[model samples]
Target: MDAIPFLPLDPLSILLLFVVGFIGGMVSGFIGSGGAFVLTPAMMSLGVPGVVAVASNMAHKFPKALVGAMKRARYGHVDVKLGIVLGIFAEGGVFAGKEIMTRLRAVYGDTGTDLYVSAIFVVVLAVVGGLVLRDALLNRSSRPAGTRQALPAAARWVRSVRIPGTMMRFKSMNNAEVSLLLVAPLGFATGLLAASIAVGGFVGVPAMIYLLGVPAIMATATELVVAFVMGLGGSLFYAWEGFVDIRLAMIILAGSLFGIQIGAIATTYVREQLVKLVMGMIMVVVLFSRLFKMPVYLADLGAVPALSPSLHGALDALSVATLALALLAGAGAILIALARGIAAHRRRHGMLEPAAVD
Candidate 1:
């Protein structure tokens, strides 16, 4: 087999990718949809070819998702059968997405390819992320802290649709028969977005939570199952095309596994709504970071003026800063939440000890 050339192993790049993967993994484990948003772009900035960056990221995603999902399943959050059914559709969508990407590349070359992807990321994140953030904020503002666990309006609407013949019962859906017809379109769209942006769970997890009546905790955990299925199929296709970068995949896997383990265990104690709110905030910020890149791509495709060199530099710096901020904020939130939960657990145990003595 012909070997693909490796990007020269720079210590800085390796360190950066590992750090990026670690934080991204933590976010994915906690929130269920952020590794590739950070990983693929980080690699691309280090001069990995776009497709290779995506392919390697996809390869890493399957195992990480598998581990995370299994861990969350033990916590009683994942709906195995529902995730599988949705995943099968997502898998088929991955093939379709790959074909679209291939055709787009054939026609438009590298610049167009970049433009198309950045645009999709910006648009999807803007709409989806905005809704998520809005809902989170609304929840925080309107409800008392102790009683803020109800589904959002979107979930209520979805449950009320009552589409006949399309309802299927899933243990994760509280044994309710949710509309698979609804799930299919959502899953397929997620797959297409995954093919485009390398992270479909951004859409998939949120959709499950806000639109499909799943709890935020369950939605985030279940997204890993979907990610595993889609990533497995995506990896096979990329491997067939000889695009897998095993070294990068392994490096990312190393850091991500540690992060996933921490995140999985942390979820057992943190408030689920807080996790959802934090994830929602991160999504909105990341959406803008991608949006910042779209103008450059628009210029490349002749849809906008070539930005002034200084202006472009400023935008690039701002985008990087925003992305870094999002990563730090997310990781920090998870760690803090985890620590608080752990401390609370210990305090409760201490209280129980006095009662035992009595």
Candidate 2:
């Protein structure tokens, strides 16, 4: 097989990558996953091949996740034991995912691979994003201050299941006993999606929350641990195959590290429902972005008529815009929430009072 050549890093390209990386990192730190969704498409837009973009994004993810996980852990949000177990099983899923990508690339080349990836992005983002948004809306309507958010029905059902021999208890999960069988598949799916698109937290966090009955804060924080493990293994696997571009990975990582720190801090200031809100909103916006690419990919595959050059260019531009919008929207929401939380905190402590008249 021929080696994958790295893209030229012009100054403009470098700056764009860095900015997008920072935005992605902020989202990842806040919600526990999503940086890759923006970073991958941004790289591809800069002329990097799809596989190479995915590979390089994975290369950058582990360290960023590690930093974010450490910060969140300080807040007592991380479940180390749960993360480790899920991450270990997720490695198998990574291997399986890599094999699938390899065969797809070998059989169908870059265009076909891109088509497959985009199609999955569209379907998964739409379905999962819609569900999350609905849940967030419901939570917003019914939840009161200082009260814990209610578990979704799916999560309630999951917790109720009792498989005697397969049950495992975790201190982080309120000492609740859940089936290993349930946790394993969720981890595997998380790893599989991460390998495929570099954003498995979409599945991982929600599954932890809604499937395994992990609380949103802990689930989101735990996802960083899962991302770290999966990313490390995935990066090594891709590097061995000569798909990773170290320069790209390093450039993106530089900005993402800083953004991740800010994001992790923001999580402490906001309600759990806001985390779901930001994630769902980003996913929905990202869904539209990927949707715009479908027709173009279809045309490339000759499954649809070729678009005019101008129209194709228009769609491509629209796709990029929407993806960036997803990042901006999420970041904006988090920052606003953080500011409000700070103001409220100050008010409660009488720190917002005007100075006494002289």
Candidate 3:
């Protein structure tokens, strides 16, 4: 068997890892879940095995999420009780999802397992992302003036149906009362995705904002809390198995700290409408990237060959290129948003200053 590559602790590798972590952290701070989506692939490209990449990423995520949650709490956006309840359920759900994944692997072997995961990624992103983009765009154009609007149809319906003994009111996020019926399912789905792909926030954040009567800011903030719970649990499990990679985790954490601080600071200056618009665009682009990856996995599983061998090779290359492009685009958008926010803050403060004495 090929020997596993030694832990890459070289200066260049560490620098590259730090940069990746910073970008990923910025994305996560803004969108709720982002570092693992790019960081895992980046680690694999750097010669880390897939499982180790995931374990190290999880280890890094716990502290980062804790820091982020604390920062966003300053903005009064975190729904602490709701996040804790959902996160606890999500913790259990992750184990269930892992059990399912193991069973699937046993039944179908490696190729089939890959195909199943890819299918889930494509389908879930397409449906959930499409809905989120639609809602964000529509809300951006037609939001009511002066006050926050009522929840979405899904949330309204969810709240209306009273499940005996499941109703709960959270003091945070404006004392919103909701049904655990809605939250548990969302939490479960979040856990399932997290276990399967290591980035449940994509699904979880949108679900909270667009389907569970939570504001976007609150949803994003609370997601960090949920991520912290899940990441902590996952890290412990991995550490017990000796898969926790401290060096990799530290490298990513170093960069993420600065990125997260910048992202949090920028949040104070941007209009909510613009945030929604940017989020909508991001969802659409990422959706297409996953869609492109689906066909390759399907072919691997012998489900269907949508392209010839040479064409498939080309498409695989295109998929990787597209993923990189998506990450770059997300990072670029984050930087632009941060810059604009800082400039706006400076201008506002500048306007408040008295004219210089002649």
TM-score of each: 0.92, 0.95, 0.84
Sort every candidate by TM-score, greatest first: 2, 1, 3
Residues 192-280 of candidate 2 have per-residue lDDT tens digits of: 98888777898888888887778888888998999999999999998888888999999999999989988899888888888998888
Q: Quote the RMSD, in angstroms, for model 1.
A: 2.6
Clashes of 1: 0
lDDT of each: 0.79, 0.85, 0.72
Per-residue accuracy of model 1 over 142-225 as CA lDDT, tens digit each: 878777477668777777778878888877667876787778988998777776668898888878877887888888888899
Candidate 2 worst ten-residue window by lDDT: 349-358
**Residue pairs whose backbone atoms clash in candidate 3:** none
lDDT of 3 at 101: 52
The TM-score leader among the candidates is 2
Residues 230-268 of candidate 3: C-alpha lDDT, one tens digit per residue: 888877765665656888998899999888877666667
Q: List the residue pairs that clash in candidate 1.
A: none
Best by lDDT: 2
